[model samples]
Target: MGDVTTIRRDVLTLPVADVGPDNPLPPLCPPDEIHRPDERDGEGLPRDMARQIGYGRLRSLLPERLRDGYGRSRAPRAVDTLVIENDRLRATVLPGYGGRVVSLVHKPGDRELLYRNPVFQPADFALNGAWFSGGIEWNTGATGHSTLACAPVHAARVTAPDGGDMLRLWEWERLRDLPFQVDLWLPDGSDFLYAGVRVRNPHERAVPLYWWSNTAVPEDRRVLAPADEAWHFGPERRLRRVPVPVHGGTDRTYPRRSEYPADHFYELPDGRRRWMAAVDADGRGLVQTSTDVLRGRKLFVWGTGSGGRRWQQWLTEPGTEGYCEIQAGLARTQLEHVRLEGESEVAWLEAYGPLTADAGTVHGTDWAAACSDVEERLERRLPRAGFEEAYKAWRTAADTEPGELLATGSGWGALEVLRAGHSLPGTPFDESALGDAQAPWQDLLRSGSLPEPRRAGPPGETLVAPHWRDLLETAPAHPHTEYHLGVAQWHAGDRAQAVRSWERALGLAPSQWPLLRCLAVADLEAGHRERAADRYTDAFDDLCRERRDDGEAWTAATAALGREAVAALLAVGRTAPARSVWERLRPATRRRGRFRLIEAELLLAEGDRDAARAVFDAGFEVADLREGAEAVGALWSRITDEPLPERYDFRMRPSGGGGA
Candidate 1:
């Protein structure tokens, strides 16, 4: 190394709205829809493109619990951060929060190479329901955002390719029963920050895999990619091939051109280099280039419409610069996942830093020439062979045992190691990582019976993977055992057995709402709408009665389940009961924007159009509103015959306008 590389553990205190605690409710029921619409079969698209569009489906968020316990509440807190720097750039990483790279500063230019979010604010963006707006996010597990977005990952110091201290982050992803690692380093005198990512499937069976390295940068720039055509997926769930740069009669390469959030997945030809860059008016901004293993590159823009800008303000401090995301992924689109075979791994290396191209051509009208200019510059900056050489050199250090643990995440990884009876070598989840939360699982591994909770509290976090399910099945049957066994059975796609187990557990326990909720899903899937509503009503009732302290935790559980319960009731036209459930919610919970939306729906169901319209007139924002949900626009058309107000206009596609 030409200059001494420095690595230090530190704190980054920022104004952050806490993610609070995760919802205690296990995700037993399916979402409203699968949401992935595959219509490409007869489209005569490219063979690889056809194979990659809507390739896999994750039915529900199982194994991982729901994380809906966050809101627009803010405070300042000190976050654990790790700093790594060389002569040209400084990188600040938050190991406690998915090992996200929060900031990358080009020291020579004193310019931030990535969107350094002004504040930390969690929203309902991730698959697990808590996601912040900025930084380079390492996404794994199933799509949307990674389940690890707001969670911790194991972190330690490892040797870099240049023989300096590299920061390594690894974690056991509960959703897929796989372990992954991210190693970050900076070479002496190099302006780029290099990250090597690896996802390993230690299981003996095939697993669906998803990986996306998302980099956020200021949106007031032109994004350049190598492709002349792109796969455009918007909030409308349609994946259509469109001409790059000039889609919908305007240049889509610029983020400001779009009216709402959309994704343009560049269709780089086979055997071409994978890269994308966002350049400012001066043609100087961040560029992210990755090895071939990371096949896809994407540009996600949340445009400057009223609702889009409102969402930006909702996610962070007011008046901060908005950002657009340039992402690299394993598949061609986020709508698809590749098949990861048994006992194999997928790995890639990504480099991110500043790139300056000819400003005039980069912002010119000729799209092909614009892209070629940036490509030429990128090739000169970091040749493909140079990136491959770096990847080969990093592999030698990938298995080097990590030293000096910087932070601790969940004990789940350690528990996995105990069960597998093997070591992951470099990214070891040592026994030291195990804690009180892991006590029951450890006892289950030793004695084959999960220790039943002594308290009447809600069932704690548990595993639903096949191995854990097998252990549970072999144990003596009880309410507790049957309840968990049913969850595992459901996850394994054995609905009949799952229902039978939950039914048995419900009869014995009589008051366990979790079992009732699982049964409700079984009933729903079976087309027993009335039965499902009855079960949902009972589940909500049982949980409400079981609230011991009725504090924030209980309130959260009430709000989450109550929302679901009311929706189910209304689905079956049981508006009376739905209204009753809404009435029973705590006052503070009822005041939430989401609950207000529900209240409006309840009023509309009761033939009170005026009341429902008033809810819209008064204005409310569903902070956790789903990405493609038509709730706001659809509800507006029903309540009043008026144009969809600008503040509530979140539609990304033109199909569903302000109409009924």
Candidate 2:
């Protein structure tokens, strides 16, 4: 490593807005639609009955990427690549390609240290639908490839505090309506590229969000991270956590030898170290290190010869080329749930550099071996101060608050933290990431003193301050801000403007059920019965997209939508669809008992008291429902004007309500 302390920046030509039709970029193709077995089998029935009815079903059919050519080629073909180079390394940034670090070259050998995909291929692969793999991708906002992946960001070359060249990339994430930035600094004489990241929720309400820095490398490398166990989706898509590298006494780490395609997420055993590496067959590769804020380390390998590899290659290119990812995240894996507090920002730093170790020394499951390799490559053992120094550097550079540095662990330790009611860093942000502030007014209109706009307004007579428009103007792409604007416009007697705002919001965050539901309510108020029914149906479908394991959200959706949905289906003589709703809502009771009440109510409404009693008994077997059953029984008694028999402990009561 050189000792000079200067920095330099080289800016390339600016990227063009759109590629010409004659360009060699791959033709855009729509992703294959997701079709469940039942849906596929329903094809023989009448058109209405042939379609599966659910929020998830409807959402799965909605087009993810826009069909127009302009939307398909939204990302520019030519990028204004920025180069931050020093004597030891050169890092290139593609500001147009999601501000990705497209290349990290080891200056000595003039060889690429990170995987550089030969072609710039964007496909419908990310959660928001478009994604491109390779180099270091800043995945912020939610899981998958992030909204910015393959999209342009605001980038500039700046001077670091240490007088080094820094490349800063940032953009507003429209889905979550938040601002985030990544600053890359490579000192004149250093081998590593240091990255500082900040995600801010300017509003008083906090939102859920996920972030990760995904670095891709050639598949011939072996990953060495501090982990004793690995979690992956096993048979039947069930998550199974087993010993790392070897599951069921079978080596499962490398791609060349695996029988089937496997996605392995290792639980980082040492959060204090905050580092992981991928060493190639030549004993040379890259080392990724970060502050405690970026504690999670993940390794993903697509089998050398498998269906998964073919599927991925089909999107990138048809070839034998394979790659693996070494990701640094704020949680155990990138998919874990995380929340950002209102008016708070999360800041962290990470580094990537070339590393060389003795051949055959890398071991994926052994933490000691991995640390030894890092020590050998760096020529220094990381002492306690090493960790503290990194933390101090991140804190000082980002001007972060001490209280905001969450004291958490990695891997299972993070899982334990989540189980304890505290948010883990880098987890997937969900709709509930808004903390407790679900109301759009609290997020957009409230000035900390004003009353929230009521839904049952004097029929669209609620007042909105002029500043609220300014907020919307500043965050034009924010779905929540747009939603609030729509409500305010409706109240101010601007129904057309309200619909336009809502339509825009829906386009940005199609799965946000509240937005869909609100739109439906507005339609109903305007006597647009067909539009209202369609919006309500879309809202219900959107709610189904929530992971079933999220019991609170799942149950809440079922409780809010189930009764009306079931009644409507039954009223139309759609018993099968009504039964399906009950079955779909059944899993909600496994973790929480709220949905059990809905099931009981549905049964009782159908004049099946015996079945309702049976449902309650079964619900108790699945979850602890003492409190829920008591509440449900009380509601039932009031609604039916019937007093319950004494000594009836719903938790321990006999099935069929003691042979009532």
Candidate 3:
């Protein structure tokens, strides 16, 4: 309530005080304001402040003692560790903790500076060099430590102005142990960090506490979250809360660089959970957080706006200094019994750091983890007996239908059986076996007739029925089946037959995704560049509409087909068309190393070596996809007509080549 500027500076020095009789006092300084001195020289200004003050300020604050300390402790022992498991994404967790993560490093390599551990000096609490009166308190009580007491869990000493070191502390508590279990990973290679913290009340007495993860963002960082309503509590308790829908859109937080003073809280309606992001202005990097549980949680974002007043305004600014505080339960006592009990027993918290600047790079990792999480949750909610029974029924139906089709000697009868199999409601097609089905279908297309019945059909029908008659009588002759049949022919070396089958498939299901995809591949293999480009374009368009809801198959298909489409478009001298396709697909495709090689090809065609090299650099980061990268390198060598690195190899290699 004193001068707002002074309050922002003094907030961290003050002892934990109760905001109410029951709740622990909210910390004074915002969580992000805590400093780390070892990384920086003097007063450990939060990352945002350091940026505003300029690196020159950082250089001037270079404390001699800290410099000497860093020189000696550059390879300090692992203070904390988190090991990502096979089930969890290795990429997300490795980059998230920055340098503090000693056990796991991302596949390509880690980002510099962002990932290093920070050091702290006590005087960092004050804007000036004077030592502050605060110290981190590690406390636990029989009633469980108050959420407010959870602050000061992590602290750092960073360089300050005037050649001194300042202490910066992060106030958030670790819900899980360091090196805890990672439950899942997105196909894109990002990880999901999950930890459960238990809060216990040994005295058997009810306790009231307000809990919020003091998630801090650098000063110039942006914090975005899903919201149904937002409220501001400041200016002598003048509270203003408004209703809104929960969604992603334009900047809703402080949008301008100047409006800094603001403190606000948002309430999510029941059954809603939100994903929040802390991003820099240019969108180059971001730190994202979310609560996995669907129970409604409160969001609190407070920070000094561009106006230089910390926690003042309610409006959002696109680029500004601020941080987001996320709260769950209004007060410790108010949290639902389940949440309290969960917290008492074990509370789960996860954090994924900034994915690379290219959105596509992170998409796979994000989606994989997301899908796994949803699947697990769904399974947990389903009745075990009913679920098991349903699963078994679907599998049996799929298997039996295939068997029945082979037993029908007449080709039309077999087609009818297969169609019925495909149409069975709720059949869980073994997607993993899809590749297996390709060979038989291809062989049939090549032979143009069944050479022998694997199993004899009903006694009256001949196995070699008229093709046209069979097509007319078969179950709708859907495009998907025809496409697979084409793939079978292609694999059998009957290119002409393969093309015909694919064309037939397209005729039945003009917009069927799988059919269109096969057509595109057929066109490519046949050296029909323009046709391939057109097919690829159409298939990609269809995929875009369904990407969000579909599972891994859709994701992988979309990315793979989209990349090929881009390459085909480029190959046909449709540079402009290629560019458009590239633009649309780049965000999702560029993350994997193979896409980079394709991108490099497109760039090289444009005579932009610089851009092509940049793409290559990105590809090299991926450990598994290096074959594509090497192929591209070989292409580059061909362009120069000179053998370069030993890694270059031109012949196409199998896909899915990279490893962590």
Candidate 4:
């Protein structure tokens, strides 16, 4: 080897919008799913696609809390990064932030192959919330961005096939309860950066699997994939088959041509090489190609319209460049999930590098010729046989034990290993990784009961998996056990049992809000608005008293609970008490942008449109305002709308219509 590949520890200092503490409350199953299995599936569906259209049917987000507590305010912070480089290419991986490959540089031309964000700004884009845009993201567990989008992953140096170092990232994805790992290495003198991903379903029963490697490239490029047609899901939220490149009057292959945001999943043929690329006017750009196991290719464009443009600006500093996502997934589309067999794993390899094709050919009006040119270039660069050999080599080296622990992720993986004795050879979840969060659950495993209340902050997060539920059920009956057991039961769809367990827990304890909040949610769902408000009011008051002297963790908890309580009271037409709860909030907490919006809503409920408009006029950005949420626009329309102010227009879909 002329130039030895290197893996080193590094830091990237940037203005990072803090991803604040997670909400302490649990989110139950929605009354109905956005897509139902019984509904006639989208036309030309693939096998098992219909079944997976509703993979989240009857789903609950219990163990994972919503992370909507981030803001636009950012300060310089040193984010830890792992750098793996060869003479030709340099790859920077953020192991602390979901193992996201934050940057890839092609050294020959000194070109950045990815659109690296200038700032680490958190927004309401992830499944559990607080997601930042840029780089190559590992999307797993569901249709939306992974719960691990901003969370860490276990990382360590492992042996490469050529005996050099490789960075391996592994984590237990809680939403689907599976362990997955990604191995990244660069061969000596190779320009391509290779990533090998493995997702293991350790359960005895089969489970749905979702994996997508999302790569972001500059928006001002022509994207090409090996297909003549695509499954287009637009802001209108309807799926239809359309011609590649040009649809309607413009060519969407260039991301900015469209007026609204959309996803175009390329309809690759039965045996086409799996790849996606974005080539610039000079026909030089990044190309991401994966092994056959990773079959899907897609392009997500945030159109050049106001909302889309605003969203692009929102994810980074104002002057930073914009980007579009060229993604590869296990299924034909992100809307579908593949069925993974029990105790089995799916593994694939992906290569990302610079692609320089003929500018005229790639930018030509003939879509077929453009795609063929890129595909032929890709074949010349990385032959299918060579790619297959590399995959096989990676498979053989996958089992090599990690040499050094570089970074540690969540303790849930180790907790799972201790609970079920999962023998994941390549990716080890060492017991040392277990920390404070997992301590109570580990004690439950060891001593058959939870540890005493660790001071009256918000209740330690609850686990609602079936196995954890069984343990909770067997633990001696007490307020703590009953409270957690209720959460478990609720997750299992046993509504009556869950309510009774919570009631018993409240009976055993003196007005704990954790238990009360769950009961309040149940009441709200059951059309008991007044009763829900009553419970919510009591819960807010109790939490205020309990977390009086606690710090920011409790501060986050109080803010979350207070918001919920106010919303419940307002829904029940009890503005007086809602105002009371709002007043009781910490001044700083009430001043948050989210709370400002809530205050505006409350003022509007009190028939004070001028006050509500003033709240809007004073100019506050709900930093974590949800994607596609009409909350801001709806309030603007109600408060004497002047065309829904362009500054606050974050709408992705068409306005003035029913939307999901």
Which regions of candidate 1 deviate over 4 angstroms? 31-35, 38-42, 52-55, 657-660
lDDT of 3 at 545: 58
Q: Can you tell me which runs of candidate 2 are displaced by over 4 Å?
A: 1-77, 234-236, 259-261, 270-272, 363-371, 375-391, 399-660
TM-score of 1: 0.94
In order of lDDT, best first, we have 4, 1, 2, 3
Please write out the lDDT profile of model 4 over residues 441-505, one tens digit for every residue.
99999999976675566777889889999999999888988988998899898999999999998
Tens digits of per-residue lDDT for model 1 on 319-425?
89998999999988887778999989888899999999999999999988998898899889898898899999998888899888888888888999889975576
Candidate 1: clashing pairs of residues = none
Candidate with better lDDT, 1 vs 3: 1
Model 4, C-alpha of 15: deviation from truth (Å): 0.9
**Alpha-carbon shift of residue 570 in model 2 (angstroms):** 24
Among all windows of 10 consecutive residues in model 1, the one with the lowest summed lDDT is 33-42
Backbone collision tally, model 1: 0
Worst 10 residues of 3 by lDDT: 62-71
Question: Which is the better candidate, 2 or 4, if ranked by TM-score?
Answer: 4
